[model samples]
Target: MPSPRPFSRYEFLIAWRYLRARRAEGGVSTMTWISLIGIALGVAALIATLAVRAGFRAEFVDTILGANAHASVYLSATSFTNELTGEVYTQSGRIEDYTDMAARLAAVPGVIRTAPVVKGQVMATAGDRANVAEVFGVTPQDFARIPRIVDPETSVGEIDAFPDGIAIGSGIARELGVVIGDRIRLISPQGAQTAFGTTPRVNAYPVTYIFSAGRYDIDRTRIYMPLPEAQSYFNREDVADEVEVYVEDPENIAALTLPLMEAGGDRALIWTWQDSSGSFLRALDIEDDVMFVILSVLVLIATMNITSGLIMLVKNKGRDIGILRTMGLTEGAVMRVFFLCGAFTGVIGTLAGVALGVVFALNVDHVMSAVNMISGGGAWDPSVRGIYELPARLRGIDIARAVGLSLTLSFLVTIFPARRAARMNPVEALRYE
Candidate 1:
């Protein structure tokens, strides 16, 4: 008769019988269940954590790039000598040719749009409430180009009416107890230049619009006004403080920096969003690495149970091994039989974990809503978390990493016990029986 192929039906049948044996027959049925459940939970936790991390990072970056410029160009200070006094004075940098500079920067290959901005800080008051606000003076057309401001779903009021009034964040409106069409007075410390020095400038403008950028800090402290009004209020006539530049791709902003500088001329100083928020991004990267390492340890521990469970099975099936060996079963066949037992548990557990994790990530927002309803609405705090709601995003690479870690550990730990079972002496095993 021809020799049976490797992993033939007989070996599979024997392995299945061993897995299905009852406890009364010296089976490790209970340990097998424990190992399967442990692995499933470990894999699920890792997948879920990675999903949340990815989602949070994406949300954070979206908020930043959506609400603000990718980069800004400012004029460097220049030293000028007084013609008659024979003295030199350093003049504060100002973008005197801001309109021309914006058009020039807009012509760069990767540049999408450019806007001249006049920014300042002032105290805002509405009735009895008052708060400090950082104001951005942008043209109505340029303000409409901001993704977060013009998103119909999140913003209220009209962009066309912005030039006649001012736009305040929802958080600022709440703080000042004001609504659209209400007047809010702004007080600036740098006012008219008189003999006794400058006085604070105070003016009131109707709240023509309100917006929510979904970020706590931005919504709480930022206000938008017409460029003309901002220039007049801040004492900068026919000049802008800086020019905000938006690019095609913010992540690869470095490639465009030299080009933008060349276009902006000698006095231009480019500051990117990366320069301001690089440390935060670096912290997030470190956090992702640390979380993966910690969760990998959990997976390793769960897979260790597979080792223990398989060792116990080898001990319980000692008499059966003796019979099978004496019946002409090769050592390789015996090892394959035991290997299938552990492999089955790992495969099934990983599939189940993947399903559970995917379902959880896809509906994480609804889950948070349900939780908030049950817990009386304190589940998420935007001020503390920097996001209005919890986010979870599933990525293929993350899932693959989790699956690879679990299966590698399971296969490696099964080898020792399977080899021991295969090397067993039938004479000695039957002698004990």
Candidate 2:
């Protein structure tokens, strides 16, 4: 066959031709196909895992920030002794007229809104089942300011709705076998001290709304009651346990601290959502990093096939190399041909893997659903994933990085055998044949 132009045009065609030629043409080999398959599979695995992890974290972060305040201001009193009487005295260190403090905090530049809240633990009983739940005393306006403690579809969170009823998480409802309109008794940790003695405070309220934040921990343990009722139950009326603060940018919430302290006064103790959930988010970051490393190793192992495939081609085509040398083909040209041979596998495999991975990540939820159906009912654990839905996120930057790694490994593997071809002794190579 006439040699095509030996530079860019000809070299690429020659390499591609070898990739597409049939086994009968002494071009395609089993190892070549294996190498392609290996690289493609590795790239796809990496992409799919990354997308899923990203999706899960985004969902987790959104859920957390929505349900919890960006920051909170808490006020409590510590008793001090009276110097003259030598008697212990309870001084007012608490934020007085907290409603005024909330308004002032709201005016701070970064502050988005503020709501007074009373948070406490209560034993909740629904029929025969009982669970300890975190109770929040909030107004309908407060619920609106916070993330949906109940599903919006439940219609229990309207500004005017649930006037005389409590909103509980769907997970708690399921656990207690309770539903909307069910009468549940809440026993507060605080008590009313009277002639009878200090006793646990108890009240019964009808469940008017059920909510799901897609967080198992919250769904199983969080419930909401009106602020006035909470104060009455805890016996701290005209007062609040804390002021929940929402800010414009929660990622930089530390910036709001000085302003908030100025508004809420020196006695205010502040906590941010990040402080509460930092460990969980950090754990997720570590997992993502580890996964990238593990999957990249898989690609490395896959590229190993290229090294063996190139070595095999050199051995099988020794006579061909000799004939090419006789025809005045330079050592450099020979090396280019072999190098292109490996590049064909790596580039083609990387592209194919990227396509496959993107498609798979986008449809991962469907794939998971199909698997669940095939495996029988309830194959997925709701407790582990919060709801039954799969989360998937894809980023262009991440995809590009993964593809780059695959191609780099693929192109590098061909160098060794290509060098050997460039240094081939044509006379000896033909002598054996």
Candidate 3:
């Protein structure tokens, strides 16, 4: 007779029979179930954690690049001579030819646009409520280009009339008890210079637009005004503090540093977004690595259940193995049978975990809402977390990694037990019976 093929039908049949045996008949059904559940839970946790990490990072970066400049060009300090006293003194940096500077910066390759901005801090008052706000003086056209402010889904009110009025963040509007068409007063410490000294400049502008940048601090404090109005209120006259540069690709902004410098001349001092947020990004990367290591250990601990379950199955089936070996089964056939049993449990558990993880990631927003409702609506604090809502984004590579880790562990732990069953002495196994 021809020798049976490797992992023949009989091996699978015997493996299934052993797996389906009743618990009362020395079966390891309970242990198998425990192992399966452990592996499933572990894999699910890994997938969910990775998805959330990815989503959080993406959301953070999006808000930064969408609402703010990818880079800024500031003029360096220059020596100025007093016309009356004839004394030379150093003056603070200010871009006098900002319009021309913006035009030149916009012409650089990979640059999308450049806007001259005058920034200042002022106290905003609407009725009895008052709060400190950071004001940005930008042209109506430049303000319209901001992704977050221009997105109709997240912003409300008319932006075409932005030059006629001012735009305020939703959080600021709420705190000051103001709405669209309401007027808010802005008080600047640096006002018109008089013979004696300077007086505070106070001006009121109607709110024409309300926007949410998806960041708590930004939404609570940022205000945008017409460029001319801002210059007048901030005492900047025809000068701008800096020129904000928007590029096609923010990630590779360093590559354009030389070109941008050449465009802005020797007095240009460029500051990229990375200079402000690189530390936070590095912290996030470190956290991701640590989290993966911790979750990997959890997965390993869960896979240990497989080892215990298989060892128990080997011991319980000693008598059966003796009979099968004596009847004509080879050692390799016995090993293959037990190996199939372990492999089946792992494959099924991993598949179930993947399904569970994907579903959870897809519906993370709904899950958070429900959780917040149950906890009386303070579960996620944007002020503390830097984001309004929790995010989850699933990647194919992350899922594949989780599944691979689980299945590899499951298969590896099954080997020793399967080998033990195969090497059992037929005479010794039947001696006890």
Candidate 4:
């Protein structure tokens, strides 16, 4: 058997000549340019869309971790399950000695900070309206260290100034028609076991602060109060519901979890942010995957254009191929000649698309702003997304995938036409001449 010869420059020269052929000389037609542009646009659009999805996912992760800790140490004694609701009542983790355990956990290698908290559900009422919300009891100082508790519009303020002060989300403030310095009633469903056993236990607190957490659900349903005051109100004096833990590096939170569990003891239940936000993040992942498949269909359609152009080229160049075959060029070389013509378009288009996509992705926020300005519309409305600007980020892996898929499709589409051109009988191809 003979080894295959090295690729000859003659093959590339023929391919280039065929691509640049004028209509008079049976060269490339207008359709070739159209197909090339179609592929370029499709690739560019896919890259931009993927970048935006990636950026949004990152933003969401940061937002969630900003308000919540990396991990939490729950001190629950026992948990109950409601068969009907499928809700497990873990009923806040209680620690007998929060201070000692928190201090110990703080000294852990990866742990950055520890905060003890009390959590429950309570009804808040001011004026004639009342709404049920999640109440968190945390010291103002510790709460401030939790990343996003303070924004330009709001702050926890000084709870020490007013021992009985209350801090609520901005949405709660609107719903209850209350403001800072106004009194709102807090009703706990866990009533004291008295003569009227398990009625609602109610108390009034002055609103001292308002926080806007940038999440529609959390901003509307969250309430914050002093930890000591909450302990007294809930009859859990000197005890905390659980200890929330923050780590030095959120990406490597697992390093702190095992040590936290050891410090928290065998009975303690520790949960990470992943556990709490698992379903939500998974849904986002699924959406990204769906978008990728849908966008890739555009490239598929563009490849069809390549197929059409190559088929036309084969029909027009039948005589040329016959002559080339007669000149001692193998059938394989004939096929390669046509394949390179189509592959050239694919390669150039893919490169151009990559450059276009990266530029668009990096400047997506700016582009949106420009569009909004020109249209005189609030396209980047913060109220709609709780974000001032649309997000976008480029990843090398995404570009590689897009380019690979484009080139693969381009290469495959040419085989049918290239093979058809190669298989023509030299006699029949030249018989009419």
Best by TM-score: 1
lDDT of 1 by residue, 223-335 (tens): 99999999999998988999999999999998999999988999889999999887998999999999999988988888888888899899888999999899999899999
For each candidate, C-alpha RMSD in Å?
1.7, 2.9, 2.2, 5.9
Ranking 2 against 3 by lDDT, winner:
3
Q: Where in model 2 is the C-alpha error above 4 Å?
A: 1-7, 21-28, 90-94, 154-159, 377-379, 385-388
The lDDT for every candidate, in the order shown, is 0.91, 0.84, 0.91, 0.82
TM-score list, all predictions? 0.96, 0.92, 0.94, 0.80
Write out the backbone clash pairs for model 2: 150-211
lDDT for predicted candidate 4 compared with the true structure: 0.82
Instruction: Give stretches of model 3 more than 4 Å off.
Output: 1-5, 25-27, 79-86
Q: Tens digits of per-residue lDDT for model 3 on 259-286?
A: 9989998888899999899899999999
| Residue 413 of model 4, lDDT score | 87
